[model samples]
Target: MPFPFFGDDKSTIARLLSTLPQTGRVEWIGLRPARREQLLTVEEATAETDRHLTGDHARPKPGGKRQITLIQHEHLAAVAGFLGLAMPLAPGRLRRNVAISGLNLLALKNRQIQIGAEVVLEITGECHPCSRMEEELGPGGYNAMRGHGGLTARIVQGGMFRVGDEVRVLEKSSA
Candidate 1:
């Protein structure tokens, strides 16, 4: 069957056809108590519905869209290279809570994903880069993280997840 296209825009067509859900593994986890605080790598974390991680300080009230933040492992190197860095940037330095591999976090926006065995998160929006990137990533860091800042999620179901946990995209019916 012939596929529909948006005139000569192949990128548009590709975006329209790439809605299938994806799966990835949880590569790392980070937590911090408050803004401007140092991030700590953790072996596991408890995700609470409508709240930030158990020990995190940014826990907004219920219904807050920024309950959790996630970044793709693939984008780290690209962001580093964009800043003309010689080494791969650390996930903690990016300030995102979870670093996942094997799936495009950008495409997961508006979709529901299950992490580890129980935690469920709804991709609410993009985690835009803040001024902190400038100080944390050094000069030009903010610009380097602009489009590669990863995604923000809202926890739908509370549970525990750890490093190496499998992140699965939930079906529409399950979400």
Candidate 2:
């Protein structure tokens, strides 16, 4: 079969992917900046944001507003290659809570991904590189993913997402 994970093939990622029995729900749905210990759906997260005043840094933090994100696994390897890191077998290098393969994350930027068992995530926008990336790599790491196409989205519904769980694009691509 044809493999679709991006970046340099890390043994860890390959091992993780191999552990998956089948490729049914090969995509991983996720949430970010969640300070609540666990991830929340978009509606709930948004409601919480509305309840708090702007710049309220009390509990949930201001940045944890509802959002969604998606990226093709293959693209992640491309990032390592671009960075010249020789990313081999490390699963978490992508920094994505859920690593999804077999889906066109780059093409589906700013779209919604629905999980049958739990919730729906509204694809907000691209998840850009930050200084943290530089910290992860050496110096020019951030420059590697300049335009690789990772998305940032809000969760519309709250639910549990696990590894190997199936994901369906419940909504059409917005852009």
lDDT of 2 by residue, 1-175 (tens): 4465555667656554333232335343334443433322121222122122122222433344323334566677787787775763233444544456766555444445665466566655667777766766668777876775466555566655555666666645447
The TM-score measured for candidate 1 stands at: 0.89
Candidates' RMSD to native: 3.2, 11.6
Residue clash pairs of candidate 1: none
lDDT of 1 by residue, 35-118 (tens): 779889999999987788999888687998989999999999999999999887999999999999998888778878999889
Position 30, candidate 2: lDDT: 35
Index of the highest-lDDT prediction? 1
Q: How many residue pairs clash per model? A: 0, 25
Angstrom error at residue 27, model 2: 6.3
